[model samples]
Target: MTLTTPEAPAGLPAPTTPGRGRGRSRRAGRADTRLPRARARRPLLFWPVTAAVTAFVLAFVAPFLVIVTNAFKTSADYRNNGPLSWPEEWNWDILADVWERVGFTQKLVNSVQISLGVVLIAVVLALFNAYALGIGRVRWRNAFLVFFLAVNVLPQEGMVYPVYYVFREVGLYDTKLGYTLLIGVVYSAFGTYLLTSVFAGFPRELLEAAALDGASRWTTLWRIVLPMSWPTLSVMCVFFFVWSWNEFLMPLVLLISGENQTVPLGLSVLQGQYSSDPTAMSAAALLGVVPMIAFFLVFQRTLTRGISAGAVK
Candidate 1:
């Protein structure tokens, strides 16, 4: 052991000179250098995006805050208090008054029935129309699409009188079926446009493959096209539902009887008849907002995905 002359401490190689080790380290560090300054600064790009997002959220949330706050307010509070002010306490009686005055349950049921009917008719017709426009070799395709686009651009005011006259002539005036049909026809053009784009983007190979396997056109559409197009369909349904539910002008023109009035019309009636009750009006408006909010919440993901897909491809 003593003669082991420090036999370079068992398995260890002789250590390099300090300068040499440092030189090697410097070279290795250079070789393993990270990305350039511009590349490294890429993460800073999100700053503007973050700012934009912050601004957007504030803008949208501000009005919603006002609506929700006013719903809890007394008439005096709404008139005298600041919009930004928070509620001092919960107010239950205001909601109760609104519910009774507006016949909230009956109006809500009518709205549901009308909106559901519109959606059913519009979506069914839209599905067929979209398939024809997108996949079928129907004549005057561009003209047809352009016609719908033109319809969308027209002021609703212009259609109202014409529609009123037509419904009057057909003895369909003051009927739920009339309003349903009117809203469906007016709104269906846009739905067809949306669905057409989605259907057009579908890979033709899937359709062809199904055809080769002896699948009829209807069968293929039922099994493949509709299933794959759910995101777009959901977006359309939610959109149409919101539109139909919120429609005030059409319902006003079409529905005359107390038994047939939709929620929006009924809310308007309450507002006029109960001008003395600010609490009631605010409450009725708040109640009216619930269905639209629920519709968005339920289908928001599908709407987002459908929009994203549409944008990308």
Candidate 2:
């Protein structure tokens, strides 16, 4: 006899296979979830970071704008209107008057000479010092590095007397070469500390290859290390230049002659023992700041490349 099959209830449909429909359903669910997540990520992190950076830019730029506007204003207008107001007239004469009175051309030359000298000497000294301590693996180098760091922490104020006495006794007093050498060597302590850490992390493979090729330490340093580390060296030069250019107390103490006074020292003359000129002082500030701005603009590409190169390798 033939057997008969069971049938579904009248209103119900048949059940589906487990793997086939379930896999397609899971994929559809994933696609739906990802659409919402991608939409969520579209606004995340970017807007907040952009807003913070914009605020910082404005904070720095606003002061410079105020300075420029005030630099263009006449004494009468500035006195009447206040620092925040726009200039009534753009007076180039104020700048010329300040320039002549300050002997800014002479001061500019002094600053350039001192700053460049400091950078050159400091970079060479730091480079050699770090090479020995870091790559050479000199005896007790860690101890030496620690000592250098401790020296850096010593306040410049405390060392003033000893340095002044030495300079006087050495007959380097009131000369450009005197303080240029002094500041350069003093600043090299920090550079040595910084470069030691960098050199310590240098690739041992490259160093070993140089050694295997019978390259002397000096040859290796000049041919391989120096060229590779040029970015870092450039950064160090920039720092040293800026530091020397802005040096005030040291120059004031060491450079007694009026002709030898740097930008900062010369600008201080405007304060005077008896009287002050506000418009001229503003103009002086503009003159002092312009060189630094120009220097930064010229080196901006170098700085960006240096930082990125450092980050990458």
Candidate 3:
């Protein structure tokens, strides 16, 4: 007996076999089921997280609001009106007065110079150190990293006096160069700790390829590693700059003269023994903060990408 499969109707595709059709239907059902579940959970997940983030932002912004509102008020008005209240009268002259009285321009110059110097020296040293520890086949690499980390945790107060005495003996005390070097050294440990992980995770294949091309380690680092790692490097620079800019203890102890003191030190000078002007103080504080806020805004995109890159694999 002869038998033949039936033909599909004109212009219609052949029907799938029962087993294959069942399998496809099952997969389609699964996809359909999963989509609704995900869609259903999205709002449930989104609103709570949104509410939480909003609360966190408000908490952070509340203090800045207080400072800004009070900064534009007269001291008497600020005192009478309470921190939460709006200023009765806007006194814009307070900023100019505070700026001149605190010698903010000179201190700003000092801060800018010191912060740039610290960032330059610290980032260069950290890049070299991280390259050695992370990429090179060095002995006791883990131990060296641990040592760098330990240096970070060592309290500044513990070493500050000894460092002060040493700087005094070496005639580096109360000098811009001295203060810059001191802060650079203190912050380098943190930079090393941060960059080492980034360097260590770099692809060994690239390093090997560079070696095969007869590129020296320094050449490979500058040409290959550094170009690719700039996001991380830039983030580190921003952090180190901010830290050095705001550093109080080292600059306070090291930079004694009015000419040498940084913005923080200058702000302290503004709060004189006989004068208690909250409005002026607030203006000075706001002035000191403005540059940092501007810096962060300028580098925010790079900073965000760098931080996220570091956080991920």
**Per-candidate local distance difference test:** 0.82, 0.89, 0.89
Whole-model lDDT, candidate 2?
0.89
Better of 1 and 3 by TM-score: 3
lDDT of 3 by residue, 189-287 (tens): 888888898887899899999999999988999899999888889898999999999899878888889989999887787677887778887888899
Best-fitting candidate, measured by TM-score? 2
Off by over 4 Å in 2: 1-33
What TM-score does each of the candidates earn?
A: 0.82, 0.87, 0.86
Expressed as tens digits, the lDDT of each residue in 1-313 for candidate 2 is 9965556688997666669799999999999999998889878877998999999999998988888888888888988999899888898888888889889999999999999999999999999999999899999998989888987898888878898999889999899998999899888988899889889998999999999999999999999889988898888888889989998888888898889999998678789888876677778888999999999999988888878888897
Q: Write the per-residue lDDT of candidate 1 for residues 60-155, one digit (tens) a residue.
A: 977776777777876666667755677676687888877887788888999999898888888888898999988774899889999989988998
Ten contiguous residues minimizing lDDT sum, candidate 1: 1-10
Tell me each candidate's RMSD, in Å, in order. Answer: 5.2, 5.6, 3.6
Runs of candidate 1 with Cα error greater than 4 angstroms are 1-48, 79-84, 87-89, 273-277, 308-313
